[model samples]
Target: MILYPAIDLKDGKAVRLLRGDMDKATVFNDDPAAQALEFVAAGCEWLHLVDLNGAFAGEPVNAAAVEAILSQSKTPAQLGGGIRDMATIERWLDKGLARVILGTVAVENPALVREAAAAFPGKIAVGIDARDGRVATKGWAEVTDVDAVELAKSYEDAGVAAIIYTDINRDGAMQGPNIEATAALARAVTIPVIASGGVSSLKDLKDLRDCGAALNGAISGRALYDGALDLKEALKALAG
Candidate 1:
């Protein structure tokens, strides 16, 4: 499993939001590109980035920051937030984003997901952020009754690269990931599932690795920033 270091952008700075709350953000780095290079130097295989401002505004709010990271690092990065259209999707992919994650659009306009997945082929991923097992969208500001598993299964043949499953309640809480829920979702579909949110320690990474489900990998944020989890140690642990 790949340990994807997360770089969440808020107001052009790298920050982490507790439980997806905008008001509860903690800025970690001012230069996101330098941060990406640091993670790359630390041996992270992939980088997971989110545009907090873009997710709320429905457009690329942190494009400059994202572009900077892309230019600085050769490591493949996947990004989510404020990408709800074909043009934006194409723009990001054209500018070197290895993959583009569709969240709100996956819930609001699933056809776009299908179209993008088919058009890009192994470059489109669906980010299913859920609370209490129901999918949340628009940066987790709105909750829906849509069942997470069913939605994932619906896209079973959509040719999506992966499903990034995040549990909102645990995000940035340092409580650990929802292993059972994430494993179940992975087992329910053929497309790869990447667990996100929480992911507090090396044990959590080990737990996810040994969860017995065919998960693609996992994404983590605050813990790495706060030193609760050492990047080199966690990477080595997962390497086993």
Candidate 2:
């Protein structure tokens, strides 16, 4: 398991939300690029970034902050939120993002997912944020009737790199990840699934590592920021 460290940007600052609520966000860093470097310094293999503002605005809002991170860190990073079109996808990739995660478009415009996947191959990933197993879009502000597994399965042949499955309720709650749900999603689809939200401890990382679904990784934000989970320790545990 890769143990991706998350950097959620809101108004150009690093923050973690309570159940995806924009107003409930708690800022952790004044400089997102500095936070990205901290994760890199601790030897994280990959970074998971979400533009909270962009997700809500449906366009890149934290572009400067994200670019600042890319400029400072050499570690490969994957980003999601507010990226709804081909032009935006191409722009981020060209700006040195290792992967562009398509979430809302994966539900609203699956054809775009296919087109982007075909165009970028391993550079594209689908983010499935679920609330009670139904997909939530537009920064988790809108919930849809679409089943997460079915959506992921639809892209089985799309050649997208991975599926980032996040349990919205568990996100930033520090209540631990929904291992069974994430594992089930991984088993239900051919795409690699990365678990996100509420990953709070070293044991949580181990649980995901041994979850038996061949997860690509698990994302942790609040835990690391609050010192509940040490990045180097979690990375070592996952590596072991």
Candidate 3:
């Protein structure tokens, strides 16, 4: 399983929230590019970035911060949040993002997901943020009755590179990822699935890896920032 170090951008700063709560954000660093460099230095293969402000606004709000990280890092970064249109998707990909993750669009306009995947191939991915097995849109502020597994199955033929599954309840809580649910989603879809949310420790990564072995990668945020999971050790564990 691939270990993706998460850099969540809130007001142009790297911050982590408690269970996806915006008011509970804890600023980790002011320089997101520097933080990305640190993760690269520690041996991260890919970087995961989210625009917290953009998610709520339904548009790109942290372009400058994301550009800075892209400018400085040699590592490939996949980004999500407020990337709802094809123009924005093309813009980010043109700006040199390794991949663009479409979350809200996946639930809202799935045809665009298929179109982008066909046009860009591996450059497109689907981000599914769920609260209690129901997919959430607009940055987890809105929950739908859509079953997570059903959503994953809907895009099976879309040719997306991967499905990033995030459990909002476990996110930033350091309680560990929803391995059972994530693994179940992975099994339900032919496309690759990357587990996210509440990845708090080395054990959590291991558990996620075991669960998502048939999947692609795992995303970690507060765990790495809070010293609960050492990036180097997690990398080694995932490699092993």
Candidate 2, residues 67-145: lDDT per residue as tens digits? 9999999999999989999999999999999999999999999999999999998999999999999999999999999
lDDT digits (tens) for residues 93-134 of candidate 3: 999999999999898999999999999999999999999999
- Candidate order by lDDT, decreasing, is 1, 2, 3
- Where does candidate 2 clash, by residue pair? none
Each prediction's whole-model lDDT (CA)? 0.96, 0.95, 0.93
TM-score of 1: 0.99
Best by lDDT: 1
Off by over 4 Å in 2: none
Span of 10 residues, lowest total lDDT, candidate 3: 206-215
Whole-structure CA lDDT of model 1: 0.96
